[model samples]
Target: MSQINKKWYQGMFSNEDWWAAWLGLFFFGLGLLSIWGLDAVGWIAKPKTWEFSNLIHDFSWSKLLKVSSKNYHHLHPLASLFITYFVFLILTSIGAYFQKLNVKKYIIGFTVIFFLTWLTWIIGHEAHLSAANATVKGHNYYQEYNLSWGLQLGGGASFILALIIGLIIGNFFKGFANKIKEAAKPEWFIKAAIVLLGIKLGIMSMKAMGFTKELALAGAAAAFVAYLLFWPIVYFIGRKYFGLNRDSAAVLSSGISICGVSASIATAGAIKAKPVIPIAVSTLILVFAMFELIVLPPLYTNLAPNQPIVNGAAMGMTVKTDGADAAAGAILDQLMISKHLKKTGEHWEEDWILSAAILTKVWIDIFIGIWSFILAYVWIKKVDRGNIKEKIPLSEIWFRLPKFVMAYILVWLIYLGIMYFFPDIIGAAKSGAHIAQGPYRKLLFMLTFLSIGIITDFSKLKGMGKLAILYAVALFAVIAPIAYFVAYLFHHGMMPPVVAK
Candidate 1:
């Protein structure tokens, strides 16, 4: 198989990575127009917290759904939702066409996925499942709903519901799963969402530059240390104990210890391993990532409720994929915030915990290119000395680099530029930025949860018993514990800011 050393702009138009950048940047640019007093993103629809009995008593579209911004409140809720659906369908279909996917299947699949996603999102926002019990600024959802009990999951309920619904189709309804398979691109969806998260980080910097900087630095430090510790240990175990060949061992090590599917593919390309090595390993990574996404959030929430930042950063290190890590972080963020609000009647702002996870994973994503380049050089020079005639090109780094991160950084810098250089328009900029980072980013996340579930098939692990065992043991026994320790070392005392009631 060919390594990823193609031309600099080879995948700019055809690759999902670049598509993520294009989609995210396009939305961000629209959001930037708000500084001119235009509300370009306000047409997007978002779910509102509502109770079932109240809605039954007086059913109204306004009770369940609303436009993202007040500027578009004049639009009917269903009209706003239709606009959201139509816009995304057109945008993603263009991406599918460029990427050479079957455009027909993609549109059909996306249509089904989109509405199903919204259905779960609306249901998950039912006050009994999602509303907080505590009064915040004189607004108490529990009292308003007259509920005796609640899950208080916040937006996490939607995420969980989406995953559950997707998994049901993926596992039980084989034919239907195949139909939507064309639109189930979890990595693409998550990468785009991460780009929108850049807006959140930018706004965060404006509010608490010191804390944001500390969190970013701590995440970087923890990620670096964990990477240093994770790879060699897993590689040694794969070789010494598992008796795997060098190629399989290296690919598996990168898959399990690094950033999952992308790391596996990069390492395979670096070592000139057969394409099947990474392909096989990626299946394992995706399946295992689903389990982590499902189990880790509530586990950490109950286990170390006080160590919010620590748990978040640890999740960033431990979870294998960007989608799973961010999803798990979002769930953890909601659970921790909701629990804390119930216990203390103080609301901690959202996204800080989730940011901890994404920042750490972003650092890891940034390093994968350098890591792969070094591995390629070492493999050619030290391990395969007979291949001296072949030279590893520097372009390999560029090819393997995660492209969405570039968009994320650019979006963040743009926000910062406006904050420092054009302070007067900050309010206008934030009006749109909030919608971009809030409802828009969350919609992408909801898609990611559903898509990830639709793609994962546990039965695929049947033949790879030994590899699966190694993955399970390494992930839980070694990686998880070490990752948590490194996260705690850097983020022990850090905490999310409390919102005044």
Candidate 2:
């Protein structure tokens, strides 16, 4: 039960990577039953915007929560929510048991995290915090609620609130944080969410096939160009200016310039660096990712309000971890769509901008295996030939490849198959696909935001002064601007589709 992949199928059941695929596809299968007139996925509960005074005067669960689809309108909101909790608890507990985590601790921790996450989600959906100032399809929550002013954050408010609450616990309440650490698996949650996002991408392709193709190609090009420029510059700076050794510099370079924690681990394994190196670098990555997640979305939304696609692609390259990048993209999508709807009376189709971010990140995620293989080969042959004993294995490529991306691609292909071959069932397929990509994907995102914050202990950066400084400087000054420019070059003039308001 080695966590590291030794055999081709070693981690199929025991790895979080593989579990992401399993859980995503399992739910996806349930959603697909809609094509046969089944409503398997509609039982998941979702929160709605609510006014505090109204709820206090006349309290009802219906005011706060509802099942995802009309087919399950007969179920009580609390019953639906309990079913959602029970289902996730059982499924994730099974994964934890296989992955060799403390099952009891995981269950308890997951329960606390789930309820806390839902509480934050519901609070963030307060009408004043989430309602847009504009009227869309004759519905204006702000006007309906008679609010004088509003933050108008949409779903981004929930994401931000979840992070803040988790951060407070992680930083201030260390004992509680340690208790729940076993279930704070942000990467796993986000990967599963990415798999669910395939449904969104598939639906998008059905609507705008040509634009989807262009966006995918442009994302690939931008990722390639960024890799060429990012690693070398960061490596040179780490080695020359920061006075780090070859292994430290290389690991740090990949962590900062490529994907975050995964790249650090892969690069460290490639060069046979001490495990402590990637662990330390991973701490840096998680902490900084929180900052980027919090700061980048609003900055880009206001700074380049008109360049929605470019901003999203830049977010993909700039944010280090998949969780943070996708979180930032979701926030950017909501903020930009809300801003445009308020100003121009046009609502941009949701998830298109977020797709831009995920598409670029997916390309980067896919290349890590190849990049690490080359690094392993170079380290063995050219860099440290005498020290290394074993030859680099070609199987490392498959080992390091993100399994969830394969699930994502497979889901997308299935949708395309339906679009081309079974066009008539498209309406029914969309009914379930929307729920999978909507409430189900969003719930995973909420978990990711909280878990990411809970795991990130900013106090770890206190002692690693030089490395932290280099990461901060390299990320903000060098990487951010360059990534944004590269994103703009590839994605300029591309815009998200507008919906009738």
Candidate 3:
């Protein structure tokens, strides 16, 4: 009987969550058609690495373009890039239109952001800036310049570059930043990417079914235990130290404990907190999430070089926002993988570490929905006894549920089924799967990084420094250590499956 219950299906079409599903599945379906030898989605523009010196010395206009990996080699690189841009423009524009945003601004802004993202992508992959120690065994770039400072940052260097560029624009050119904020929807981009990630997981799961099961079960358990331990301690801090009201404490607790902005907003609504509480907390969470994004990857890599899965799962638990968390996980994935490959001469599988992070975050995202409902009921019946007659809509759970997760799960199940039932076509399926999971997914992630930087305005946290301080302290003092231990408890000794050379 509540308003939250009224639009259970609205997220299906009205929110970024469904848009991610629709967009992801559109390409996934194209990949699915590849079983019949059709490369329906192969024309998407994918970038390749080139040295800055080479690019400067002998750069042709064509140097920047490449066809989507091996699967879509038939397509022209330039055409693929344009076609990919057009598809994303239309899809994201539609989402903006329905969300009651300035559609015209979104399209133009997205265009600028898109090109800027590609520019950063190309620059990021410059051999000196992004290369690892030639993990694939073809080239030994490590020996090129004595391997002293080749960055060795991998693709993550580019992502960080994009984020830095966006941050510069966001902080220094605030007005211009606001104009493009309509298209700076990092959460939307990341969710869409997460859906595509499901395809990757499915393909990877097929390769090592036991590994997937162990990683997933461990992630779920870690998330569950982390949530149980996190909320109360954070709630106590907000109440005892910060002297926050119950609603504020609950929202802050969820923001820090659960999946960041989503949890903060969900808790606020459930507890009937003033909207400003969540809004303020969401801002704090976003800014701090960036802080975590920037700091956690290298920190975790140094702290636990051997425990790749643990570091990743810990990233999922430590970083608050989905965009920041996933982004951090991705950076950590690249960092740890590159480091391990260089040190051990073994190419540790790429997405498994990322999957550990995302899977844990997904579990937390799923749990937050149920947790919000329980909180609502408790608040109504126990805390506010006068409102005991009021029924909490079961729809709140549906509303809070992350829809991209649904898309991710669905894609994973469908792909896993294909692998199980029609094993013969898996090779064909893999061709399309690579396109879906690699180039397409990377595009979304690049966009996410840029957008996240664009929208994050650290100066806005000026008036709320105390809350920010509290969040930072709690994150470092309480959250990070506990999360690491819990993740290590379940995921220790878990080595990512190595890729075949």
User: How are the candidates ranked when ordered by lDDT, highest leading?
Assistant: 2, 1, 3
- Candidate 1 lDDT, 1-501, residue by residue in tens: 232436799889889999999999999989989999898998999998999989999999999999988878789999999999999999999999998899999999999999999999999999999998898667898998899889998888999999999999899887999999999998899999999999999999999889999999999999999999999999999999999899999999998888999999999999999999999999999999989989999999999999999999999999998999998999899999988888888888999999999999999998889999999889988887783499778888888889999999899899889889999999999999999999899999999988988988888988988899999999999999999999999999999988755
Off by over 4 Å in 1: 1-5
- Residue pairs clashing in model 3 are none
lDDT of each: 0.92, 0.93, 0.87
TM-score of each model, in listed order: 0.98, 0.98, 0.96
Best by lDDT: 2
lDDT of 3 by residue, 1-501 (tens): 122336567656666777877888887888888899998877888777676666678876466678775556666777788889998899788888776678999988899999999999988877788777764756665565344568888778888999999999899999998888889988888888898899889998898889898998999999999999999999899889988888888999999989999999899989888899999999999999999999999999998899999999999999988899889999999989888877888888888888999999999999999999999999987876783369887878888888889989999998899888999998999888898888889999999999999999888789896788789888999999999999999999999888744
Per-model C-alpha RMSD: 1.4, 1.2, 2.2
Candidate 2 lDDT over residue span 395-473, tens digit each? 8899999999999999999999999999999999999999999999999999988898898888888998899999999
Clashing residue pair totals per candidate (backbone < 3 A): 0, 0, 0
Clashes of 3: 0
